[model samples]
Target: MYTQCPDCRTVFSLDASVLAHARGAVICGNCETLFDALDTLAEQLPPEPFRLLPGHTRSEEAPKLEVAIYRPREDVPVAVAEAPAAPAFTPGFVQDRRAARKLPRRWPWVVTCLSLALLLAAQVAWAKRDVLISDPTIGAWLRQACISLGCRLPLVRDVHRLHLVARDVQAHPSVPGALMISATVRNDAPFTQPYPVVSLTLSDADGHRLAMRRLHPSEYLDDAAVLRAGLAPGASAALLIEVADPGNRAVAFEFGFE
Candidate 1:
């Protein structure tokens, strides 16, 4: 049976026979407050129905039942005299039961740590985005991820490894007042290099600059070339540029990578 303590409002379980033998009087185990269990005992009494009675008539009260209280004889033998009282029935006494608390599971923390590690790894991958995009094997995986994740690929733009191979400026035969320029640049580094920006300087016969033009990668590379594409070691590209004539005095030109 379940019992609730009135003093501390603590609920606990107890045996019915123990409660009956104790005569409905128990000390609260939680608050250490001695209280009459009979005052707050849980009992189910028979219900009485309401009925109309004549004003002059009187109702008889129900007879009460006599209960016998048992006590040991004072002239009992030595064995009976030495017997002890039941501890549960003693006043100011309570039963002590130590209950262990339950602990929460650890899988939640493990999952959180795993999630944080994945986030850190994703950040590192993004930081080295250019290198991954330039690698043929890794680039294929990255491109598939980009397609699935709805993301754009970043460009590779390292230009220090680019070197000018040959260049020349000549007058256009068909177009009046126009000059044609042709140049070849190579990737001289031991590793692959990114597309480069070319700076063209038109000069007079004495090497004094007449005009300058900056050519972006898009303006020079073919439509098949893309930002994620790279130049292999020792690979070269031929560039063709058209410009309005600088003048008859412009006799030479120079090309450089930025």
Candidate 2:
């Protein structure tokens, strides 16, 4: 029953059930200071310079019990050793500050699931951007990423890869009743496309239909720089058309593309 530590005077051999479960406060495993083990509550050991009993005071009341460090070992025979019961106040830096407050609550759900998986992969790459820009290696890497994102890219039309190749019609040696026609086309697509919509039709010599037209890359491209650079992969172009004579029973003609 001897207890001393009024600030490290270090004595400790406690056990009236460790001072009735420490209602007599304890701490000082060599200077960890805390006091009142019944204020130097002794049963012996009073012969040293230690002094504290004429009406012992120091208890201001706050440490309700937690035990473990009981020091008495002079060759070990002072036996009633029951102090080992401490762990309730959970101190290992308070469980490392509650594991650092559970890492900021899992970093806001790991930054909200990585910002919703990058906004669902940017809405599936903007909803398959025209089937991923018609894939010629993803349309040349999305036209080199839309030229630094200034953004334009749309041309690549396929029109069964456009073909025609050659054609002719006749009689317009200067437009009397007009009817020149002519053609060529080509672009068997490996990528660059665009100029198509030609169509014509005329028929009859029994083929029936008669007079139909469509034309348009500015009415058959009279070369304003090949109507702006389109149709390149395996290129070709020609075209000329004139029109007027859907009479003379149009002797059958046809062609189409768009």
Tens digit of per-residue lDDT, candidate 2, span 1-258: 677776546666877887678688878888687777886576777665745533356668876767868876677334446565565767789899888887666778889999999999979977776667777797778788888898766566788878888898898898699889898988876667778888898988888887798988987777776667688778887888888997788898989997
lDDT tens digits, residues 182-208, model 1? 888787654456677778888998989
Report the C-alpha displacement of residue 86, candidate 1, in angstroms. 17
- Candidate 1, which segments miss by more than 4 Å at Cα? 1-103, 128-154, 189-194, 222-230
Query: What C-alpha lDDT does candidate 2 achieve relative to the native structure?
Result: 0.78
Error of 2 at 11 (Å): 73
**Model 1 clash pairs?**
none
The collision pairs in model 2 are none
| lDDT score, candidate 2, position 187 | 87
Off by over 4 Å in 2: 1-94, 106-117, 124-140, 143-166, 169-183, 187-198, 203-248, 251-256
